[model samples]
Target: MSRLLSKLSGGQPVASAPVSVDAHSLDPQRSAEMLAGFEAADIGWFWESDAAGRLTYLTDSAIAAIGAERDALIGSELTQFLATGDSDDLDSTSRPLKFRLASRSPISRLNVTVQTSQSKEIWWEISATPRRDANGEFAGFHGTARDITKSLAQSRDSERAAQFDSLTGLANRLRMARKLDQTLTAFKKSKRSCAIMLLDLDRFKKVNDTLGHPAGDELLKQVATRIKKLLGDHGEIGRLGGDEFQILLPDMDDRGDLGDLSKRLVQMLSQPYSVEGSRAIIGCSIGIAVAPYDGIESSELVKAADLALYAAKDAGRGTYRFYSSELSQNADWRQRIEDDLRDALTQQQFLIQYQPIVDAKTHKIASLEALLRWEHPERGRVSPADFIPVAEELGIINKIGEWVLEEVCTQLSKCPPEVRAAVNVSPIQFASEDFYDTVDAILNKTGVDPARVELEITESVFVGDLERTLKLFKKLKKRGVRLSLDDFGTGYSSLSYLRDAPFDKIKIDQSFVRGCSADDNNNSALVSAIVSMARALKMETVAEGIETKDELAMVKGHGATHLQGYLFSGPISIDELLDRFDSKELEFKPRGPEKYRAERRTEFRKIGVIHGDSRYNVFLRNLSKTGARIEGLLDVPVGTDLVLDLGDGQLAVATVRRSEGFSQGVEFETKLISDGDRGLCTRHRVSPYQIEAAGRPLGALTNSAVAAYTTGSQSVPRAFVEVDMNAYNRR
Candidate 1:
């Protein structure tokens, strides 16, 4: 009896226990009364259910704790009052409370939620034993339940800490990885596509250097908030540590839509951020890779996306790139260039050429725009588009800018007083503290007239501190140098900046000028508005990239003050300019295409054309976004359906729209998009997995190769006669 009392009291000693108790004191009825009293006093409560799992009995205290009357809970279903908790050890073999009661099995410490009348859910740990009749038939269950809300809350907190970023309440690296694995596994079965985007803040390092770490943290939080607001229910986003973030978009493979979304992300992230009462500005670069096209698994997809991101950063830090098979090769080439660029400055491999910007009305030179050229010993002349970005990435653009400034000043000293020279400046160079001093020293050393030197700065310069930028402009103005806003309407052009900052000229971006003459194009109206606005602001306007006679005439009619493009002259050497100046021949005749045409890239390569069951060899003449021209087929009917095998698994469905003597103009059903290297590519390509399933290696296949493998047993059913290329060439 004493032992029983001690066990009921949870191993606590019973005070003044009789050594020899009367028979009634140790009776079963007495024991039941003591157990009931102990349960009412302790944190646990008792419950019972009938064989049908309906509540048969419950302690009055337990009923009151749940804010329910005895009558209300007596016949209620037991499972309706409780739900299973997220216990780590629960698995397939661990039966639920209802299943255990039905199977007449003992349940030990199973966690579940108890629903209450007050609409509150409380977690409880429960243990139950089955009750049976004298015939050994299952009857009901008797259980003890203790509230575990506090401990469960702590456990949940720990789990959240492990899975989420502490700084931004977004999923951390571990959670993102697991979720990506699960999503990919499921998507593979459904044959649906997924896309992953990897992005990193472009100028975040500058923010951390200028402000403190705490401020940087606040900036990241704001970035996450902005992303959430933009994405909403579209996708899942996670921070992959530091300034890097990852996004998982399910069932999205359209590059056009992806490109638009990426552009929006870049624009949103580039906006000004207010952190702790200080304004900060930054940008982000995105790299995208779609599943089954770029990769098949999480790791592969992540690596591909990272490579794309690297390419975007390499392309000048304010763009996005989609993954391609050739990106790995390009990445390697980019690394080599970055390594070689550091020594190119000392090797005397860089030179300057001047392109003449002429007056639109007089057709004479207004100012010579200085351009930088890099001559690689092995690779010949490297495009400025390629090397300038490398220089920016290497943090040597400022040094290169200073060199150009000094050289321009020296060149200006030799030119006529009316022939001013404009030098381009990068945002990195313009932000330097010593930029004004460097300009002053150059003018002083070269003894060039300040009026003959103009500084050309892009709109990106406005992304930094506006006050300091204005101060720098004032300092340069005090030195009598000219300031011209370059690529004026390309980016976020604000009228407020133009009104506040002193400038002498505004150069319309080439994009606006290229198609200004088209009847359907809005660029003509845009250019007219810009020119009129510039006139009102008392600023000179220069229309750039005037490659056609129509474009030149249109801009001139729009009241542009200056024009610069190939129609006047390509970039000329200093000696060539001096010769032209010495001969007193500044006026140049306009020479270029009369009207603008869609730029088609010329190509000479063999491809395959599949019509019906026959595949024929054809020569691809030229390619464009909308259509392609093919040769080696005679008298193919117009409106004939054919598939052009553009190698590398790019199969484009085209229709022969124009047929003439072995040359046909085929218009693609789906328009091709930019391949990020000034080349056009199909929006979707055949997956390598599909090729592997066809008993071929898992990689890109040539057009002829795929044709031979696909139509092995079938005989060719030629609908049109194939022209003999050798005979045709001889004729």
Candidate 2:
């Protein structure tokens, strides 16, 4: 082989001959031809631009791919033919392609989109080096470009898959978290507000269990669609997971607007859904938290919204709640209640109270409605509203409900056979597969006639499996038990169900009864319509919550067959009821407040009253929309203006209207609004912006934190002098 190489080397000096190649292959023209062939094959293309960013040259194949002639593309501005890529990595420090070109900087593997008249877009990965003349004067950019459209699309699909939920096609938890973080960071700099609402579909688990998971999945999709339709471009909605959703609304801080939106969302979500020929009804609970108010960080804001959501659910599903600092404490209390509820039954913490159902025409006691009450040993008479839901959540509601049923049956046996007793049933207990058998066993054990026991069921029982609900009603009716629909108009109010369900009586919801006396209220018309319908169906109508004479007269005029409420009697113990029956007090004379007034919650909370640099510790005895009654300030004269610092940033400027002894009735300058849980709160609260301006963190402000905006102001003229109640007492 060495002798042959020496012969091929021309036989002159083969000792140090360099590696040999074909002479034709070494020609510069042939090399250039090979490079041109590579370009024509679409492996890559060459591009050049002048110092003015005008395209000087482009490969013929590249121009052909864009459906343009080389001559036409040559003089076009580069930016006119290509745009900067929308890459996530483009940060604050990144420069645009035009700026890079102007600065004569080298760019490597920069992804760009080619502008074209074609319907389809083309993506190019480009690498370029800025060229200069001998004098180092900026000349142009010389670059190689490659088509990366297919790879870019694959990348984008992967990114979308990672960010969006597969089931509902909404943003998943990871994406939502990142979006919240980014939004909060950006909004912090602009000092703009953002609201985050976290919602969970109520009874969704029941839907999943009753129907298959596929139906639940379909329901979730419909929920997402409805939310998008209602929100449109107002916000971004995401399904965090399995019936839980999060909404991001930017630049919205108004509590009134938030409250309305929350209510609308709940209502919209509560509408019945048709899933695969099966009807599914579910409600939603919303918890809303605003940026720089509830929290400034993403995690903190999400937690606040979650706590608010829990409060909404605890208040009874199908409602919304705005986050207050107290919600966290309430959440802890709820957890404690849930723990305590597990043992409530065995500990005998529950008792039954009966409220009389009177005949509207005769004003005579017709029957009694049994209500469940829980008296926590430590908490002292815990409201059923506060603990029944906890029992339900802890899966002990059925047990408690069974106890109530048995106890009510025993009490009904004690009452005269003519006086019947109505027992309230929870949807959970009513929907049990063995509910019919349970009722039969209880009746057999107590030896009470079924006709003397009316089973009162709320509208919620009609939510899932209507056929089954109708069958349950049939079974109960077959046992000769009277069936009554309780809180009739407060829920779905489906006329279709009312048409088929065998309801012996229809009870008007207290909400309607509460406002029936108002001349302008639509509740009167609703009650009239309900009564007319019930009469047509041969069913009796019972007006609930008739607390005033006017309300009683209105329902009676509207043709209500029976009346039940405080006007007749409060809930009494079974012993007290027996005693009343023994005393022959079956005829109830209506005795209640003369007029229907705003609901005033009775509470005992110590709060601060600021009057001209003096902060007095006073006990708030009762609070209402227009005024509050406070004690501990003796001899506070009328017309004295004071700032009431209800904790959690609620500041009310009130003037004492009535002063007697140590108690004062003060009217609010601005009426309070519903706090979403049967409580009253100021219409407006201390703004986080003010807190920030006061050099404190943006959140629910402490009294000291908000004092700068409220009592800290010294410019206001004093209306009255501060009186030391303690000093007067000492004297």
Candidate 3:
């Protein structure tokens, strides 16, 4: 009874009321009465166990709580109802109460949760001391158990609240960091891999600015739900803060699978969300990094992923990029391009190129797509694909877009009445409040008929306020200009878009047209369906990127009205376009490749070619995933094995497939992977740590210095004659 008093007031909450009285010095009868009152109130239950650890004595209230007959429980083990089955980590945190009973040691304030046969959950804080028989031998034990369920739950909730985001109910940054560290540390020893993705909503600030913060918060909640649904149990997702999210997928090393997953995430997250009874659409960019390849440590991996994210955003949003060693070197180049774009804007160094869209049946010129170019004096013709996103971020895309409209109109004004011009519109430029006025001003200044100017709008334009977009399209159409949906079947495409959009044409994106007729895939069927839909909508369908005769035939047979691709003609200068028009030769014929070859790419660059133990400089005339052509080595047999060092930690083992004079074609032992920028790369790289073991400071890999670490080659007699391609070119 004295032991019971030591615990009831041992700073634990009482089931009913507090017992402040110290009964340690009280008479035995008074203590017994107090304990009896506790049992009657059901505040706690008392039980006794024999030396064998079997229950011997229990109160009526405790017996009822056990949900069993007294005879059944009297000889049962006390630990049987302790809920040990409910937890695996419990035994590691503290000594099992049953073990203490066997050792006859006293237990003070040990809390555990238990479930009865009836499945009732109860938390108990128990205190016990062993007793001795008259001969001083172990006899039995007595303990006091009290209900502490309420307090325990409150404490746990507080702890969990600290680790989770209140808005999204996901792990916070601190918890995610700890989780990543622990997983990476454990997986490193096991030689396993994990992939992490860092992503954030693109143009999310615009949502917060246009809509209220409450709508933004609701949008974030919807985003979290969408991500959780898509990922399911495949990965752990956390909301770092704001619109940023992180995902950790275990046992994932295959970059191909990672790329597919990243693509899905970007697409799913970019879908429109309903916020406060209004439709809100936003896009996302994702960056991926795999463990032991990108980095073994959590911090290093995170930094790599962050850099990739920046690259993806810089490339234009709604895309995903995987981390590569080249990204570190490209940081300065990215900034330089941004600065160049700004210069091009101020210096008016931009130029427009025109690609002809020909009628599918007549093969006559239908219209010309005005492609923007930045002709840098030193860098040659800079690609708009690489810099247009930068211009948008710099808030100069609207100005450039305005300039494009004016220039296109002015050029068309001098051309024949039937020669039409189609101009690409940036989503940022299209969303501006004064965009309509700018178009009106351009048309008035150029004196070109509105019918001759066709504005090509991508599906991304649907991302803005739907009502506003509808009104804007109608307003533009009311001015007698034609609207064409460009890049259809990409970026937030929905059938609902066509039901209301006032478009005269639908341009199938180049991606679908690339391999439509080559493979037994759905691309062909998709193009057919799109053409059928366009026909039903009384709109012309232009199959873009028909770079082969087969793709052209397939789309034309599917009832496409127009075709635009290199198969017809590549983009041309204004002077070249005017000359062709003056010559009155508008009909184009079939050209370009006979069929699509996805692996092959024509690349002219200097690469390191190694035969036996010697490495020599060679000119790589063409490159592919499985093979490449080199012009440097002579007298090499058709079956000779060589190593091609493609730089940036990429080494390919190859065998000569064809050899003649100074030119040889070699087939690779393994296929190369995409470096996330339409470039080839190796799946794995030589560990810099291995070089450190050979007596060097550890750092990132340099292909030239790390060749020994990769191939383990030593100096030996050169087996093939070497050729200096740079000097040979002069001949």
Q: Highest TM-score among the candidates is held by which one? A: 2
lDDT of 3 by residue, 1-731 (tens): 34444343343323323344455566556656776687788876776778888877766777676577888777888788564323432445567666666677777767776646776667777777676666978777666677777787787678678888889988889889989999988987776778899987987877786778998898889899989999999988899999999999998867777777878888888877888887777899988887766787898999989989988887767888888777887787778888788778678789889999999998889899999988898878777777888788789899899989999999898777997899999988998999999999999988999999999998877764778899999999999899999989876788887999999999999878888986667899999999999999999998998889988989999999999998999999889878878898889998887877765778788888776567777889988888999898887899999888887556789999999999999999988877555566666655555665777664545665566554435556667777877786788
Q: What is the model-wide C-alpha lDDT for candidate 3?
A: 0.81
- Candidate 2, residue 117: the lDDT equals 83
Candidate 1 residue spans exceeding 4 A from truth: 1-38, 85-104, 117-120, 519-521, 599-621, 630-640, 657-664, 675-679, 688-731
Please provide, for model 1 over 1-731, each residue's C-alpha lDDT reduced to its tens digit, 9 standing for 90 to 100.
23333333332222222122342445555655666565658667766677888887766777777788888789999888876755452444656766766677776777788877576667877777676656977767666777788897888789889989999999899989998998988987776788999988987876776677999999999999999999998888999899999999998987778888888898899877777776677888899988867777788889899998987887767678888766888878878788888888899899999999998988899899999998999888888777887888788998899888898888777788899999999888888888888888888899999989999988777664667888899989989999999988754577878999999999998889987999988999999999999999999999999999999989999999999999989999999999888999999778989998776889987888888778888889999988999999999989999999887567899999999989999999998887544577787766655666778764333444467654533565578878777666678
Displacement of the residue 324 alpha carbon in candidate 1, Å: 0.3
When 2 and 3 are scored with lDDT, the better candidate is: 2
Say which prediction, candidate 1 or candidate 2, comes out ahead on lDDT. 2
561-601 in candidate 2: lDDT tens per residue? Answer: 99999998999998988898899888899998777887799
lDDT of model 2, residue 417: 82
True-structure RMSD, every candidate:
5.2, 6.5, 4.2
